[model samples]
Target: MLEPRLRTMWLANAASGAAAVAVRTPRPVFADRTRTPRETVVASDLELVTVTDHSAVLTWTTRARNRAGRLRPVPADTEVRITSADSRGAPRTWFFEGLRTPYHYAEIRGLEPGRSYRFEAYSDGRRAVPARTLVTRRSGTPESTGVFTTATPPPGRLIRTIALANDLHYGEPASGLFAGLFEGVRHGTDEYPEFMLHALLEDLRLPDRAADHLVVAGDLTDSGTAEQALGVRAQLDDWGELGRDYFVCRGNHDVRPPDETDHWGNVFHPRDRLLEYFAGGLRIIGLDTTRVRGAGGTLAPAQLAQLGELLRGEPERPTLIFGHHPVTRHAAVSNPGGPGFVLDRANAAALHRLYASAPGVFLHHSGHTHRNRRSRPDSGIGVEFLEVGAVKEYPGGYTLIRIYEGGYMVNFWKTRSESARRWSTRTRSQYLGLHPDHALGSCADRNHVVLRDFSGLSG
Candidate 1:
């Protein structure tokens, strides 16, 4: 959603071997046919996808630098050398043996919590630079250089787990296309959207990483075309049954041109009404924050009234509301973004007021900003507004929410599959080498534990 989408006229990219199509009127939808597929920048570095009380997932990709401003993927054996930071034990190395692929992932487990461990990655036995230590601390200390803490899961019985994701942007063939950010970047050979989503689905399908349910926040399309929308939906259909195993909300790009022929609107947001569902004692709500041909968001007076009434009816039931646009001013102003980046002040204030009254509403999640951030506009309002990073690009992944009897935990994980890791690594130079700084949030923002009273909720 950070990219420029041409309106009224389409621009062709012969480099991508595609012709652009022209459109008309207040077109806020995606210009899917006009995008330039090849990225012109490239970078490669090892990263900590995520760390936990007992395990850590480290991933990276190898690339061959290019003087012509595009790097090609290079195969290299993957390995990670790890040891106790204190040097109290013999060092160990783990590997994805027998594979010389561009993408690499090494998972280390069985470490003690509240302790630190030193680790480094190797490409074909060559040590990766800037070796760092992983501090799996539970002491509630602040994060420091090269050392991040684990996700402090709540102390109690875990009842339900939800996979939180947004901005799939299916049908788009490339990423990091917003500005001249493409300078020196290299786009993935595979269709970027499908590549990312495939990795997500595969990761979520793993036994140890599965979730009880899934929530796709919004932007489920590159442009509001029937083929694009249906394609994304069909892929998701393989994940599980819609409206039961998973749910979706619409985004600005998902909005089609105001034409009766556009079936994408009918396919997804027929009524633009709030979607209410449940997983045991937890209540899930999906709000449609977008309007036709508009980039920002709104909560109509009638919709607000309805939401207030619904919350009042179940004042103490734990609830989570999600949408495409951030709802709180703290979230809106947390980063340097343009107008229409969030909900207008009026609707935000109204939602905050409702949250102040409904003690059960704990979180409001959004994804347009494509960053992992948490905010509370008013401490007294009792709602945490969270903006999760996009699934289609750099730092590509989803947020996992584990609701416990006592409270909840939030942790973000980067997709570790071959195509995803390669694409993610190559896109770091986006926005002129500043994309990582803006998209990759601080450790605290990506992982945290919040205590709340949820005695009434149980699986």
Candidate 2:
């Protein structure tokens, strides 16, 4: 069957004759075989793209005109009229601004969590699309939106379990590479990166699976703007106390724009070189590998020496290192040259040498490639160099680190909230229209266990 957007258009009989007509608000008009007539206001693709406890995204497409068959520009003041699906409350309207094409998108906020909602699209105060039903996804589901919840949140004064997310790209304009290069791409359909991060934060704080601590490895923002950096921190603040409950390091995108002053003020300055925090018997080290705007990462000689010293100080203690770029390469679609996808070979080798001798270190996590992958360093480092997909776009999620007396394990938990999954699935198109599973990664990327004696670490 044809999709909803396509089905919205119909061949209605005309008063003058049985001419092929596409439905329009006032009346049906001639159906352009090569293009959608300007009067054809709506087509099939109307559907909910994502839903969180308090927010949801809806998108649709309209008919186009001209020989090129380009989408007719969407009418200004297009909005989504939303109300409780059960009609328990008054309706609210969400609007879009600065939109340019036939694709219509809007995000509805201020909704109640776990509540169902009904919404319809309108253009210039006229109904542009039919009403649809949506249910806000529950928080903390294990695998999918309707599945089981994760393990219970541990009590205070227990072994600290930290949640890990990287490559949030808070101010990223588009969710995927070449986002605007294709005509199939819908304008403003994807959720804002900040919204995606907000949903991920909700997952981090879910009951029974609450993270005692949170660590963002790198690439917190797309261009390291003050607004993006501050936006990232603001979202984290909504989760818990910063420094005490959470910490973040920089990615290549998080580098300051090489200016003395920023629009968001000095608090948004990018000077977090590295962070070392202790959780129970685990030493978590976050390294800033971004060396000012280069796509790949490089450690300054000073930072490298500092890392060596930090590792040598307590080689017997358990340690987990994280950065924005991977130390080892993985099988992925994009294979760029230089230090673009993975860390500099020399830097990775040097770090591998350090960890190989430092028995305390067992895992090295990074995120920049925006895909899940796992590989042990080639130099026999005994450490898992794992790269996680982006949390701001497809495969939205974070890694859950559970420390036990005998050992620790890392699991990649996809942000399963309905909104997260929808955006994740939708943005998979940004991966060059590849299958969702291609960007989602395999089971090996989801769960892994390593047995090692970590009894010496404090619980």
Candidate 3:
């Protein structure tokens, strides 16, 4: 059986008298693909990516049309003016005029906590916004109440941080695919997987809040081809050692068919390997959540049995588990809940029992729905069931989990590179412009603090 996207195309071909012909869609090597430079600049796709206590990343894309009248992003200076009403009825303003680039990632800092801000943007100093695309649940206009707010910082002496990301879909032609129903959207940045992944790695290395480790929950590739797997590893290598500083779990896309030459397993760990890392008393576990060519996820009986044993041995260790499925869907999360989008219900119940037995597993991270969500399900209400957005699509980036002796903070951070921002903004066309409702979860979902006693772990 073929994937939904491939099956759709296959049926179409079969109907056209090529029933025996098999279609295999492939993308160029991730490192080999590059973006075409744009010559002109027209600002569009402005959005408030996410807001934090003292900082916010405001992004917009600058585009130019070719002789063929095709619109593509081009480099341009990023300029913005944010203002808030003061107590005296005057406007308090903050400004950021930044690097010239097609993907305008403007970082706004020094914002007063809990303050509302409204802003306008420019490409090359031209008031080019009222961008054609609007972030969901917000007005398109610059001055509307759709503006975002800066919230108070989570309190704790930040001990350490982990960067969480997934669904890179390397070597894929496009995203947002539905079986014979909708066409996928190509990335604005041609080599999108590299573009977005690189942005995420660079952001992780930033000085003020650098991540101590990185965990890709799953879906590191589009096709389980060796080239895609190695390509993803090379990108991860640029940040840290393969099995040390960064770790990856298998996603369904990384499962190669048995008859195919794509040996994804040779490059990545198997589902039962149960990769575990401990740093300063904090235990992080990466689970191989996928089965070959299967969209829904399950823990093989052996894998679940192994995890149960590990939790039983040190059930009180401060721990985090990262996998590829949403576990079990409940109303606390988004609407993409279905059998295919998560682990099997019975398997999830078994995992819930393991969580119940292990009091130290405070968080579980998973991805596949290409959205950002955090839920506390009934089965394991004490555990944080978080679904981070795809690193290769709209709202592309990672979630930072900062541990403190008293508690931990989970904050989503969108990649801040020019090409990455441009591509992420363009991919918002998903779900007929309703993607934000699914992908850009509420600010609370994107950023929040969980108070727990982690005094046993050093930050």
TM, every model: 0.81, 0.63, 0.80
Greater-TM-score candidate between 2 and 3: 3
Q: List the candidate 1 regions with Cα displacement exceeding 4 Å.
A: 1-44, 63-73, 85-91, 94-98, 130-146, 179-190, 260-262
Query: Which candidate leads the pack in TM-score?
Result: 1
- The local lDDT score (0 to 100) that residue 125 gets in candidate 3 is 52
Q: Work out how many backbone clashes candidate 3 has.
A: 3
Off by over 4 Å in 2: 1-158, 179-191, 259-272, 329-339, 435-438
Cα misplacement distance, residue 26 of candidate 3 (Å): 51
lDDT of 1: 0.70
User: Could you tell me how far off, in angstroms, the CA of residue 331 lies in candidate 3 after the best superposition?
Assistant: 7.0
lDDT of 2 by residue, 245-363 (tens): 77777777776666545332244324536667776667888887776556767788878898999999988778888887777744222433334657777887798789977998988
- Sorting all predicted structures by lDDT, with the top scorer first, yields 3, 1, 2
Predicted candidate 1 versus true structure: per-residue lDDT over 252-302, tens digit per residue: 878877764555556765636788888787899988888777678887677
Instruction: Kindly list the per-residue Cα lDDT of model 3 for residues 138-157, writing each as its tens digit.
Output: 55332235366676555557
Ranking by TM-score: 1, 3, 2
The global C-alpha lDDT for each of the candidates, from Candidate 1 onward, is 0.70, 0.59, 0.72
Model 1 — which ten-residue stretch has the worst lDDT?
A: 1-10
Q: Worst ten-residue run, lDDT, model 2? A: 11-20
